[model samples]
Target: MPLTLPSFHSMQHQQDFFCLSPSDSTMTENDFFKIRPYHNTKKQMPVLAKSRRGMRPMRSSTTSTASQKNRKLRYYSTLPVSKPAITMNHSFHQQGPKKDFISLLPYEVASQIVSYLDLSSLCQASTVSRSWYSISRSNEIWRHLASRWSLNIPQHIYPHQLDWYHLYKQRHILNNRWENGRVATHYLMGHIDSVYCLQFDKQKIITGSRDRTIKFWDLSTYQCVQTLYGHEGSVLCLSYNDHIMVSGSSDTTLIVWNMKTLQPIMRLRGHSAGVLDVCFDDRFIISCSKDKTIRIWDINNGRLLRTIFAHQGPVNAIQLQGNKLVSASGDALIKMWDIMTGECLHKYAGHTRGLACVRYDGTKIVSGSNDKTIKVWDAESGYCLMSCEGHTDLVRTLSFDKDRIVSASYDQSIRVWDIKTGACLLNFQSGHTSWVFDVHFDSTRIVSASQDQRVLVMDFTTGLDTQFL
Candidate 1:
């Protein structure tokens, strides 16, 4: 059967059916071919393919292409031209001014069609013409991509702002550098004794050391801005939030300092032994000690809240997640506790020797042990997921973000591992000359403390975009 074309006696109605404007009433067969729905073609083409208005119909070079084009022209030849003055019996078509395919469609409809393109294809399409360029850089296109990574972008979520696309570009380049182990290393060296524990945010780094004091370092300058003297013994652990910073000491005392003023507010001396680890959320200060106990303290006045003779041996580390607490101990076990009810929610046992450090994100738990191995555990079922083995001595401290884990050990080495696969990503054995005591990281850098009395910073953010980080 011959292909039947819609009668164009009424051009106004026929134009709507083809998604065309009034000016296209005199369109030619070539225009009709361009307007045809490309059934087999993908919405996104190869980034290298050049086109016009980003809506140029893809041309196929297959054996069937000759027949397809012939069929399209044949179909167009039979359709009547919608001319107001021309007679219906005219034999050949009389074409008017030619119109490009993109201009012929409603802009919103055209934009929706091109939104399927990935960033690379969109960029290539922008060079085709002004209309394609406008659509390619539109805020809507970039915003959709931003939402895929996360919707919490810092600024310019509204249209007409171009930072969303810029952020997307920066993150990809930074990730590639991290996977390739490309980074710069900086050192901080003022502690009189070994650096023991550390934490940092965007502006500054806070570290506790065996020097019997806690020090604050400016992140940008990498210099010690201030040092506070309160602990009579080595400061072993620390934790802080927006309002207060707390440091625990081998003096068996914990001191709370006002974050804004950096002045000591209260000192609670109750633990009979050295405080080994400390952590807190918004409401409670939780600390574990060498006395084989975990104590919860009121964050405001240093009031003793509750105590759980937490483990069978010295508690090595503790982390707080909302109302739940997880503690690792020398008894070679990890226990999750309900903060309010004081009930043991679960227990994880796998390491052959005692645990030295642990970190969790509520779903997954990563623990380092004297057994010389790191274990990843399913937080829900207490089952071991993967055992990462590389350290030659006791794994002393560990930390993790969403993508990878950074661990330090008595072997005088630091190792980075993929959080999901347990494969070692990077190893740095020369940064410290003694046991590494603490480790932490953010999106752009890894910070570690060691018994060598020095802090090493492996920074991957140089010359890369880390605005979102």
Candidate 2:
């Protein structure tokens, strides 16, 4: 028969008698041990096999065996242990202290090592020791972590009182909320027609609409702060900086405005067809048009510097960096041009249909096409590196930074993508009720314009400070 555990009372009574009267020399080793019941309430006592010595002779203080001459059994026993608990005490008295070499390293080296740890691991490490706490909470380490994540955390913020880890924690929360769609959605409602173009910074949002008026909005209050009327037809595109603003319109004209006073600086006229897009920097204002031409103009005056026959069809979008210009055209081609000499450097072609928007950051080019795919191109080799596909309709507008591509589509959706992996990280479809025309984002929020006649701001940093942008 299989061995079974007896009741606590019965087993104790039998074990007390067995230990006191046991001297069976002929008993097998298995017969020498007795299964005794103990008082632990977590589980029933188990049947343990015997040892070779009689009654499994244990050290005892209160009792002894009469027949076995001091051989004893622990009737009210505890669990067995080969070692004592004193050896495993948390004081670690038996083991020497381990030197924390990582914590003793120079600040730069320590920061680099801790940077490999994710936020959770870093937080846990901070509590491990005083030396680690000091190393993990260093401002330099937290600042590096923020930059490594490619977040737009503000620099020179409260130089004396700044806490980089706290700043990163808040920004990380905002970024996580963005991926999870936990944003506060608000609309800038002053535009009477479809909002077609938009750009923003820390202070305000500038939007152009089919109503032929450009409205400037205070981002904090979501209220229109100013309006400018200079275009006869619908405003199509615009770009601006701290000092200057340039806008393009279906009237076949480009206007330069003094951003300080929000007044017209000059009117530019060159394209035969409607001007589609405009961008400017410290030196030049670049514009593209339905006339299939790219025009370079003086930033201070309305004088046209040079015009290049850019593509076979309407140049739908154009972006400028240092001395190069990248234009996406209705002919399903993307071309890079020299702003100084008006020369075509290279042409990139992969889209099966016309291209709608393009962004160039000197080293790479990203373009959205009517074929519903976004392609990343190597600026130096004219090679298509990766293609991101998700939108079911024309990928009309897109903006990107070092990490993410925020693209809006005629499918009435805005998709956020990982720039390096081509992963579609977020798909926001409820913000707009009609075709989305433009989408832009910083680290905190995604602002988009749509044909629904409203400009939506999805603020991922709803309850957090946006001082960093």
Candidate 3:
């Protein structure tokens, strides 16, 4: 008789009966079946016996009488009586290799990879795996990211307790809030006349007015807590650091105030005409006046250290950084001066009309003028980098950071520009109903005070409808 063979369906059912060998720890029963060997009655029984050693034999409890008969007949007819029973060992089955390239990398290498991604990309990567989530939340990675954007984390925060990821998210949310124009506006009204200049830190907003008074506002309550009265004429400009403030006025004097007590600490009298602008550091107080001179004074003794004939016209604005100062004058000139020596280091003469406002970081100088144009200059070379034009009237106030410049104008508009290319990024026309007199910004928001007697706060990221008081 011809050799009997099990049907294909019967063979599949029998394959499931192969017992998993506990001794064969390398692979599993499912893995064994993935590359199962084919069997035939005509093949040598010795070769089949050798291969079967890798798997253990298992009897099927569910085999019916007819299935058992078929299995017995097929096995008895296919193998010689002298052959020993074959056992299946699952250890011979090979498993597919792991694909965890990211997890396999060293911790430093993994964090470095995450640092290259932006905030949005880094956030998405955190969801990839548990290991990846931990690596992406590393504080060093986020701190480096914050520094890249020039976003300073508050100094009051404990070093080990800083949450860089949350800090970045908060700024991102605020930026979106401004870009979408969704914000809550609080009106701070106290001055009976036009507000001229303002400075703020984390706790309070200090503003000067043509009403000859300086008001200190509680940022949380939006209420005027203290009104400083001493200046005989309209207070034109102001600067503050730590808990000390320096205010210059049309009275031709500069008063240093203890901001915590809201009282005048000392008064320095030297300017012969209206003081246009003032700034101070820890040791020196500097002021520019309509008298066409810039004076540096010793803050401790209230004595004039030196004076430079700074301009042919009134110096309207001045910014001090360390030992250097930049002044803008009505003669349409922007000059960089060494405060210690009273020597002019560089002069930028690009604006066609008198410069109304000016700011300088160590690297670049930005000036807005009565000619309705804004110019950016290279501080080191005294060369004009770019001229930004858009406002239909005089640009009155300006503020900037590493990436952008924000300007307020008499045209009743506030515009944001890309610092490098000098292209207008945003134009905020509906926020103010009259000339915007002063503006200040940080990484997230822009706040402007207007002649309309209103203060408008805008979110940087969202361009939503403007809210007003």
Candidate 4:
């Protein structure tokens, strides 16, 4: 070079005379620039010199502090980013895991689901948990299930308090017992003559016999406890509710008795001929007689209310529901009447021969005829819905529900038929040795009384023809 210049890196620990004093530490390039410049210090600067080879570099205290600060910054820069903190007050934190979907479903949806299950499956589900038990034991659920089998809880009983599962089981077992021909038979042999009509409740079996007396027998012991003697002729028919017993007699009178005391309350004498059948409710008493007339009586005062000349022949059977009454007559006609106004509303006339027995379920009129056929009629329209033909002889007594009709015939057989289709489902002949006089049924078993002086109870649970023998 033409002029000698001081080298910036060649001087060690040099300070300008006119500038502020530096700290007792190595100076950085940035720190050196921050000092005030001195113009007169050029001459004091060290002369330019050639650098020696392999010389060690000078260290500064500021380098370590700066490096420490830089290291901290670099360490922070390499760390992963953090998300926002979630508070414990969130719903997810409070509820933990989600609840079961079925348990969370609405009650209506749950009940509909439970309704689809059969009795066995529903019983099994009741043991799953408390929630399931509550749903399974609901009265609506059990009521629907009971309805499927045509089992109705009595109107006086509370469905919620009843054990539906046990009730169903008992019915099933009783039906099985009937199918297998295993029965607990009680002879009930107090009557001196044939028992013409019988009725029972939970406590007693009341029978009206040709012996001209009404006998009250204990259901459990099968022992006749009391005999009500008033009718001069044979007792032909009997009907009872919880508090009162009404009996029709060949003496041409109908007697109302106190069911508890077995004492006569009133003796209604208006029928010119023997009273064939009698039915009553809380308000009125109805009687059909061999005189071909239907009479309505005031239950309280024993006063005759109205009378209708219903048929040309004797009225053999009668049933009362609400304000209407249905009477089957030996005239081969079935008439539905308004008891209050003494008017015939509908007349069902299809049987070729006189009807022997009849039953009305408020909608359909079922009549068994001496024509050896059972006719089902529409009570409102007077149309013959179906004619069930199977009995070789006259069909005498029968009972029906929503599905099937169980009939007892003078042919000494009990037959089951589909109510809708009129197809014979099962024929039971071996059980009765003589004409089956009267038959009654619930949801499970058929109890039939026969002219053989025997009562046959048959199970309908299996509904198998092979079991009917």
Candidate 5:
């Protein structure tokens, strides 16, 4: 036995065989090592010069088979493919399933996240993406924020916090009203100092200013109808008697004006100090003063009926209901007096400081105090009901509508409260940039005057911005 090398010569096309070699030889077919050239038959084969024994080559065709196997392995190595890789590569060229993040989030969790953003921020965020827009436009989010913000609108919303440009653009398409809300249609602005008192009679608004003049404002034209001048000093207080407007001044005088003519018919002078407040019944006119006495006058004759020494300190406010005259004083006591006898009937004590103003709503007596509180009392019994507290400064004035209680404070704020529950419903932080002097509410709106030399008219429903003098 001998080993033979494979010949490097061309064979019949596509035909192959197998050969194995262990040793080299020169003579026998098994001992011969031949490597012949493929194109030339006369070329000598390369010889493996060594002894050969027990070695064998089956055929030269096997060399072509080895070359084919090597070529196949090189091609497969260039692109070694797996099942996942092939599927992924093919799928990338086509379409696949889309991911939905919104569907993955629960509705309750999504809603809670949206509720914390303010209204203006929520509105702007809506325009950035479709998903955000859909959530922001929903009624649940809007209603919830509205209720929370509206609870105390004046405290929550400030001018600096609003993005005016974005809000202005969205609200531009609105015609006087947008999205169930109305804009300010009227503005009244004709006061020198704070207009401490305002009385509305049908079409006209009569306002008493600290500038010592009472002005009648025409509602339709938003113009000053008439300027009635008689008070020598700041007109601190005023009251209406259907046709007559009685005003009290810091000059210790009271002037009764004919509402129709806007002319002072009578000037009654008696108080030593400033006449702080005045009120009139059908037959009598009652005036309170810093002189610490309540004066009764004959309304028909402009004659002084009696000067009752009712208070130990300055009488700050007075109100007439039926047969009783309710007065609050710097002595921090509210006293009820009989109109005819000029005798103190009952006294209420509990106010921490001086009572600044008092008013009666047929059944209850409401008083505002320098202690920054409002107290409700049973009008007939003079029993204290509740002391409502929220203001941070002195409560300056108190007024009553049908069921609502309005209070003004030196905190530069006005709060509207439910008369029954004593819960504050809304805060109006307008009128004065300084201390608010007085607040009054009619059936339609709230009116507040402040030391900042202006009066503000606010809409009751929307709790929006104010129109000021």
Candidate 6:
């Protein structure tokens, strides 16, 4: 039998009597009767616990405190608490919203996707939203995109105009402006026309020009060593053996020059019209002429060995790779000839316009044409491997390196392109102010000649370099 506290019914009667009494300790067990009853909404209200001091005060819900006053202060100190756990019923009623589709992608990943699109598509995609706008504005992305569209941009874009046609003029330092450049000692000039062709040995530069002359320049002094004069008209084409220089003149003659003395060794004449192009490998000199025939000559004796009459129109260019001779003609055909027997091995006819020039870089024969395109052909089979088209004007001349092919056009620009992918690597336009008549590359540098009456040299030792003819 536990002793029971005063009943609430008995305490209610005392509270009415207590209202007339005002003494501090005058109230009996009915003192608490005036207080309101607890409610569920007031779960944090003060609670009383039985103790030695009769009815003790409330304590905070922590183990650190004992006094009610200290506990009350501690509760107020922690004004903010972790959120209560969500009830199962509430969680089941709601689901998280799906993220925006674009927001799910990373910025680099978006840019990579944009890169796969063409220029027109890229421009449109950039305007789709602000995030895409940011990706489009990146210089790396735009620069790469520009390169893919056209190889004419400077390798490093500047704040100024970086278009392809204007790049050469801005970059090339003329003889009058050589002092303003970094390496002034390394430069050359000689031809009245742009130096269309260049061949380098250990010590000299042998150049041919539309001015109908071949010049030997001393590399150390950058001065004309000797001028070999024999061709009656513009020396439109040139080739070299280890010891001799062969030039094809528009005057319908091919002259072989002694490399050491720069003297005309032999003036071989057979074509009725201008001999537009010439080439030589180990044993023979091959020439193409406006006379509409391809002639193979013995280099040692300067004698015509075999003549192949394959093209109906003028043979504008010739290239010899091993025993095969490839010729591009004004008839819009490329004919492959057997060098040993002078037989027509194969004929490639696809150009709607005349082919202007051809070059053999051991592995392939690259040709340019009035059709405004360059075609790479298999030297062995005469199969057309690839055709590169972009020039607005006739592509007049072509040359190749191990990894790249270069073209000169009547459009007055020289374009460097990757051989395998047909991607453009660089565009040079500064040195020529008129139609670029011809272009060629030695093992180390690129050279171009133009009707502008000036030759231009691009030195590989410097970063994107050029010098006047």
lDDT string, candidate 5, 394-442, tens digits: 8988788556787888888767778888878666554456887777766
What TM-score does each of the candidates earn?
0.74, 0.74, 0.70, 0.65, 0.59, 0.57
Candidate 6 lDDT tens digits, 4-45: 112112112222111111112222322211333222232264
Which stretches of model 6 miss by more than 4 angstroms? 1-188, 193-196, 380-382, 463-469
lDDT of 6: 0.65
lDDT for residue 442 in candidate 5, whole number 0-100: 61
Ten contiguous residues minimizing lDDT sum, candidate 1: 1-10
Q: Please list the residue runs of candidate 2 whose C-alpha ends up more than 4 Å from where it truly belongs after superposition.
A: 1-118, 125-144, 150-161
Candidate 4, poorest ten consecutive residues by summed lDDT: 1-10
For each candidate, the alpha-carbon lDDT, in order, equals 0.78, 0.79, 0.76, 0.73, 0.67, 0.65
Better of 3 and 4 by lDDT: 3
- In order of listing, the candidates' clash counts read 0, 0, 22, 1, 2, 9
TM-score of 3: 0.70
Clashing pairs in 1: none
lDDT of 2 by residue, 11-91 (tens): 122332111112243322223223232322233433445455666735443332363432222321243665453333242
Q: Which ten contiguous residues of candidate 3 have the minimum total lDDT?
A: 2-11
Number of the candidate with higher lDDT, 3 or 6: 3
Q: Give one digit per residue, the lDDT tens place, for model 3 in 48-130.
A: 22235667654344323566566666776688768986653343233476576778999899898888976546655665666
Cα lDDT for residue 168, candidate 4 = 48
lDDT of 3: 0.76
**Candidate number achieving the greatest lDDT relative to the actual structure:** 2
